[model samples]
Target: MGSNAPSSAAQLAARAELQGFVQVTDSRAPLYARLAVGLADDTEAVSLLAAAPASARIPVTLFAAIHDLLLADPSEPLAAWYPNLVATPRTDDPVPAARELCRRRRDDLLALVTTRVPQTNELGRSAVLLLALAALGDEMGPLALLDAGASAGINLIPDRLRVDYDGHQVGPGPLALTCGVRGKAKADRLPSAVPVVADRRGLDLRPVDLGDPEQVRWLEACVWPDQTDRFDRLRLAVAEVRRTGVVVQRGDVITDLPAALAQLRSGHPVVTTSWVLNYVGEDGQRAFSAVIDDLGRDRDLTVVNYEEPDLTPGLDWSAELATESLSVLRVLRWRAGERSVEYLATGHPHGYWFSWLD
Candidate 1:
């Protein structure tokens, strides 16, 4: 089974690109990236991560997630090495340290990534939703949000979070996500307030329940180990969700689209998919696009879509997708049979900051 491995070199390369991208954009994540890159020739690491390629193709995300789990659980030995535990961590070459940690707990770590998908429920990205809602203008009146691949469905309630784009503020709400404005973002018209979300619902193949301690732990695991601020944000989002529960159903997005759309009660129904479509096959994605288009033909449906340019079709986007192979945020609308898709911003997968694309 050495040469007949399930995870092809291309899958490993995708993990590399994701790691390299994160290594550059986020200072805290470089350590994890280094460990991921170290696995290029390390047989143990490769075999451990790609035990089941279908689930492990995106090893970097999965690995980071498990680290989140181990780090949070004080009983795990790796938790001692976790930088967050001690204010001043032993930061001298984290790759070797990481390898040692994995070597020590090979079975447990292997078991974690083999089953878990790259489930990052980043509620911080709700800022992008606010931007999309603002782009629609007040004429759309109230909003009805339908989130695909919504994970824990915390992102469905972006209005409940505050967003700040380089001091251009939005929402006097619960959570605050501040992003540095860059490139065309400085010139583009940003949102001053969170849109009025009258109603919301989310669809995920495996919807995570925040009320469940185990699910909450896995969600925490999905977050990168280095990003303390993100972890804090996750805690806040979890609390909010527990306080006011969200409606997230577990079902196939393609098959569930009709029923999901039918559930929208009032106001302009806006469908938003952020980083979720990447998991769907090309055929599935085409079908997903077609479904939205077909629905738009009859009613006024606005779709806010964001995905990695590499994952999107007909995406002759900007330098981020072309050069860096990054995530691009887009705002699209179909009203009275007229449709428009616009690239609004490009940012890290975890929403550190976004360059507004005018």
Candidate 2:
């Protein structure tokens, strides 16, 4: 019989990655933490993860693939532990069930991780986006939004969704998002009115078609299994997008930006990128900046970036504020060929909360 076991080095690397994920994950997500610990020592599971591309070898991608499978077939024993799949998740140890599912569905899991990268248009971040938009509107009036790396363009509609920043509410829509405010930000500092989004467009290499059920399910699967609130919000946001359609064009952020910008005819153009520059590497990030700088020569423009501090180039504070755990929210603007930047706030990657800095 042919042996399919992974090499010792591969197994060691996978174990280290899973262990690191457990350490960094929020304490509330106990299920994933436990699952990662259990799978770290499992040779077969680690082997499957080893076969995936370097970028997709992390715990999030592995668990998301499993979650995708569970969403399709909730009959699996592992589904009992997932709050999204069960009315009341079982408190019993779920490692055995998870291992069994991994053993039985090894092929399926491998295919998913090999083919798909974890994609999330995290709606929670809209709270931060809304805040940024309010600041821009205060200075420049109504805005045109162009989202780079917009997975499903769901975030392109922050203006239509309600966000309660520690009791201060914004927006008049049905889907409500709660974001905790910290630091110098006060309730009165929030804009009295939500900024009007005159035009909204998104650029993604492969945009999710909400019209397709599978694509919708994939988006749902990307949510952490323990965060049931996020899952519920995602469903609501998806529905809102369906009711009122969005336009997400197929294109690259660097190459096709000018054409996409040309399509927007109203308001001052504001480019927004949330956790996207990291995927492009240092050179690509520099290239993207050059593109924006070149474009700003003829028109007044603004860029709002919610990304890892180290990954974003040209931001003066990126080196000083770099941290693995938080995302920095910064704004870059150009007028009459002169450039300026605003370091707005730093927050959780998912926008669960933020600490404002003047």
Q: Pick the candidate with the highest TM-score.
A: 2
lDDT of 1: 0.71
lDDT of each: 0.71, 0.84
Looking at model 2, the pairs that clash are none
Whole-model lDDT, model 2: 0.84
- Taking every candidate in turn, the Cα RMSD to the unseen true structure, in Å, is 4.7, 2.7
Q: Give the 10-residue window scoring lowest on summed lDDT in candidate 2.
A: 1-10
lDDT of 1 by residue, 277-343 (tens): 8778677777888888889999898888767868755334455455445667877678799988777
Q: Report the C-alpha displacement of residue 212, candidate 1, in angstroms.
A: 2.2
Query: Which runs of model 2 end up more than 4 angstroms from their true locations?
Result: 1-8, 314-325
The runs of at least 3 residues in candidate 1 whose Cα sits more than 4 Å from the true structure, single-residue gaps closed, are: 1-28, 33-47, 61-72, 92-107, 184-188, 314-326
- Residue 8, candidate 1: Cα error in Å is 14
